[model samples]
Target: MNHALKTYQTWLNDSAVDEETKNELRGIADQPNEIEERFYKDLEFGTGGLRGVIGAGTNRMNRYSVARTTQGLADYLKKDGQDPAPSVVIAYDSRNQSPEFALEAALVCAGNGIKAYVFESLRPTPELSFFVRRLQASAGVVITASHNPPEYNGYKVYDGTGCQLVPELAEKVTARIREISSFGQVHKLEQTEAEQKKLLVWLGSNRDQEYIRAVASVSPRSEQMKSLAPQLKIIYTPLHGSGNRPVRDALDALGFTQVSVVSEQEHPDPGFSTVASPNPEEKDAFAMAIRMAEKEGADLIIGTDPDCDRMGAVVRGPDGKFEVLTGNQSGALMIHYLLSSLKETGALPDNGAVVKTIVTSEMGAAIADRYGVQTLNTLTGFKYIGELMTRFERDGSFRFLFGYEESYGYLAGNYARDKDAVLASALICEAAAYYKGQGKSLYDVLQELYRDYGYFKEALISRTFKGKDGVDKIHSIMEDWRSRPPHDVDGTRVVRALDYLEGIEGLRRENVMKFVLEDGSWFCLRPSGTEPKIKIYLAVRKTSNKEADQALKQISEAILTRID
Candidate 1:
């Protein structure tokens, strides 16, 4: 018998397995392909943690997988020796089984004699990171798939510093998880017993209030917000996720009175029925918000993802139509606003620095350079940006003014180590108000930045690869690109090639390749860490929008042709 088949059979026969789960297994037993897909391998607990389709299989995210992963994390924590009473904070977003999975993780921790602080209800991922440091917990776990589809759910871990576990620490946890063979063998305590033992603690509005107060500190011009917020019309949608209360509360606290929520997406819906996907990056996610904004004559529309860590926005342009701002454009707007605001208020630090991923546009860096603030680059993950923040705290060298990615992730204050949409939402609105006070829209300010700096445009191409074959193809593509990088792209000679896998330019080893063209444009290709996708990032700087658009299209076409 095949190993997977045998494993499936064993699962069917195990008394410890719930009948419902076994019934699911029985339903798929006749389908060998389904059986193979489910039992071929254990669901991996990757660097940060597990993210998979919620289902009843070794390769899926279920209660058993959640418990097992948490048990392994518990064991690792014990070995790592955090404190006498090691503790972990847990938060869940609005997704099917998010609450159940969170409780299961907490039970596993309690079973290991570790204290677990769990939110009474769903909260944003950034709050989980913030409270991890605020409560002095050993670690934190957020149950969410972020902006992924409804069928998907995830478990992400954060260190005491409130950043996702770096490579070294993640390796330790992954190794510990591998040593555990059976998900069925993972021990967990009953919820009642855990509560009675005082190992389980519930976090509530107190934490939420503190988190909102911290978000208020990100406001650029509070006085201006007090005046302009009432007049500035804004529309926001959480997309049936966790951002409803926090995002709204943060804005209201900052005196933004004209804010309106999309009623259809105001409450948590596990299915996210209103949108095709809950990702804010997608235009569909903003449909309801845009319509609401149009009806209300709002100046801006903002949407947050499932976990509420990444934020996306749309602004009414000069053309009298709403246009969505790419993450790079919004990032540049925030950077320019932050530095310029600080300078105007005489609060700009001498040792201030802005951090961004290598794939992010250079426009923000250019804006920072003009302000005499230093700009630093990191690998593509917010974890890397958070890691740099930790270093900054320890060395007291550079004050982290802002950190962002080409994706919709942004961070302004150090209150939370991760990308914070709640804070970003407030800062973005304040920036809008400041610009509004000047008789302009956020879009206008962005245009001014483009004119002041060069016209910088960026685009991304993500190709999905499913199953084992897809994984191999992604690896092959990355390897081929790394080994033989393009010498010229779209008639522009390649100036330099940086293969991150070779650990060049002081960056840690990663499977990413970058080609810089003589025209000062660059493109990078790398495999996504959490998803089964290969992403290509392209950016170009030109004197005009037409030239930039042309250069970007040509370079992107050339790269796609090579891939095909």
Candidate 2:
């Protein structure tokens, strides 16, 4: 037998292998190609946790991998021991086998003699974070693949504070996961058996109530809601994910009387039957919501991803056509509305600050500066922003007012450590109401922002490379760019460069490289950590929107010529 097949067979025959697990292994062994794919290597556990296509291999997301990850987490929690019986909260999104995966994690936690609180139904990822703190659990796990396609699913680990596992803690968990040599060694207990031992518990509306109360407290215009709430018409779509219940409750609680949910995409469909992808950031995903909005003559439309950690909006433009706003544009509008409302009502704090990822538009910084609030830039991930929030709350530094990323993620009020699309949905509706009071549309607000911010525009280009050959191609692209960087793109001369992998700011050793041009046009090239893709981000600032777009297109072609 080949070494890889032998290793897998050994796992199948091991005494620790459960009947169901053995069945899965036998199925994989029946197909040679399946064995190659599943046992090629272990599923990577990085800062984000385990994410991959769901299948029967060791490389796929199954009960064994979930159990192994939970065991590692249990080991870490025990090592950082505060209590003999630490507790954890588990939540799942609307995905195929999500409930099964969530239960698998719960069972593993129970087998370790740790208390586990499993949600009664699919819930938003942010709510899992909120539940962690609300229950004061030692840790939390959310089963989701966020905006990925239907074939994919993932596991995201959250600490006691409800934030995704940070770098240091992730390393610890990775070490433990690596130590578990085979899937057969991982332990688990049946759900009923664990419940009888008092280790497994079911949680429900109590945590939901706490989250809703916290979200309600962050409203800047509760009194205005009473008067203007009846006049506004808003359309919302959960995109067949988990935000259906919480988003409606938040809108109703804020006194919005005429809110409608997109019926075609309302239910939890793992296939995301209504759209090609469940991501709110894409215009295609909003097609159903847009049709509903036009039918109902809605003023604004909002959509959340399957996991509800990211949100997007479409508003009526001056031409009477609905236009979907980009992530940066929506984030900037939210910041403007929130800060302006707070300042108008004497609620804006002197210590207020905002956080955004480095690649996010500088338009937000321009708005923050005008308000005399500090804006801090962090790494690409939202967890960095969450870490900054932790620091601010720990020390007497600037207060964390809002934090967001370019990938349609936003957070407000610090109720949840991760992005809360439900909060963004509510805030977008309130912002629409605020604009309606002034006889303007949210599109008008975006235009005004562009006028002040010099028509700042950004675009993202992602090239997917699949399998082993794809990895080598991605590395070659990065190396080629590093060796002979672009001195000029289109008609613009390169003014500066920033590399993140080498930890250099202007010119660093990192694998990421950014080229700044004389015309204020820029492009960044970086490899994705979770997937096999190379992403290029282009931004251009011009006096006119057409000029900025032309510049972006020119630079994009140049980048493609160099990389592709």
Candidate 3:
């Protein structure tokens, strides 16, 4: 029998398997293709941990897979020379079956003789990072899909320092996971028994208060926020995920009186009925918020992903129409406002630095350079950025002023090691209020920044490939790009090339390629660590906005047309 068929038979025959899963398998017994697709391979780890379409199979996310992965993580936590009395922090978002999956992981930890700190209710991903560090746990687990569609959910693992495990450590955990050949072998405990043994502890409201205060305190422009509360009308949407309460509480604590939550999307919605996908980076995600903003005469609109780790903003632009700001645009605006605020107060750190990803635009770096702050680039994922932040704390080399990626994720304070929409929301709104007091919209300020600095435009192109052959297809595309590097793009000479697979600076080797044009335009090709897609990133910097847009378009066409 083929390996896929053999695994399917074993799972079906295992007496420990749940009846629901057995029924699912039995229903598909006649469909050999379906069986192969479902059991072809185990779910692989990625930037967001074990993520897949929620279903019953080795390749999908189910209770058995979740429990099995947790058991492996548990073994890794209890390995020799590690913590003897290991405790794990667990939090879940507002996704279907998220609570159940979280409970299963907690039980698995408890069964392995490790304490489990499970949140009493759903919370944001960043808050989980905070509590993990605050409690000094052995590790952490957060159950979230993070802007993926409702059919998906995930499990992300974090180390004691609250940062997601880097590549080396993730490999260690993967090794342990490989030892568990069957889901039936996963360690588990009854919830009541774990609680009675003092192994299962629930985090509560007091911790929420602490996290809200931390997010509230991140804004240095609180005085400005208080002054312009009346002038700045804002609309926010949680996209029916986990950001509703904490984001609102943080705003209230910062003394913003003119904030309003999009009523249709303020509650927990695992299905995310309002939008096609919960990702804030997409323009459609802001449809409801935009309509509401128009009626309320709101000056700005903001939205966060399900787990609240990413944020997106919309403002009335210079054209007098409401336009969504790309992640690069948002990052540039926020950094400019933050550095200026700190400088005016004479609190700017001499050794402060900003961290971003390799695929991110150079606009923020230019703005930071104006204030004498340094910029560091990491691999694409936020975890790489988080790992760098942890290193900065350990060594006194530089103070982490801000960190962000071109995916609408940003961080301002050291309260958490992950991207935080709550903190970002507080600071972005404060920036709006501050500029409003100066009789300027955030868009107005953006135009002024463009005038001072150069105009920068960026775009991302993603091609998806799913199913068993998906991996091979993405690999083929990447290899084609690497072996046959472009000579020129849209009449611009390719002056330099960077193959990240060979290593860049002190960072680990990554599967990415970049070609820099003579006109200061550049494009990068990197595969998504968490999804079955290869991403193309294009950036252009020019003296005029028209030139920047034209160059970005021509470059995108020249490169992307070759993919097919």
Task: List per-prediction Cα lDDT, in the order shown.
Answer: 0.89, 0.85, 0.89
Residues 33-142, candidate 3, lDDT per residue (tens digit)? 98988899988877777788898889888998898889889889888327888999999999999999999999999999999999999999999999988998989999
TM-score of each: 0.98, 0.95, 0.98
lDDT of 2 by residue, 100-188 (tens): 99999999898888999999999999888898988889899999988888998899998888888877778888788788876666677
Give the Å shift of residue 62 in candidate 2: 0.5
Candidate numbers sorted by lDDT from highest down: 3, 1, 2
Cα deviation of 43, candidate 3, in Å: 1.2
TM-score (C-alpha, index-matched) for candidate 2:
0.95
Pairs that collide in candidate 3 are: none
Model 1 misplaced regions, further than 4 Å: 1-3, 45-48
lDDT by residue for model 1 (284-344), tens: 8898888888888999899999899999999998878899899999999999899999999
Best by TM-score: 3
Model 3 global lDDT (CA atoms, 0 to 1): 0.89
Weakest lDDT window of 10 consecutive positions for candidate 1: 41-50
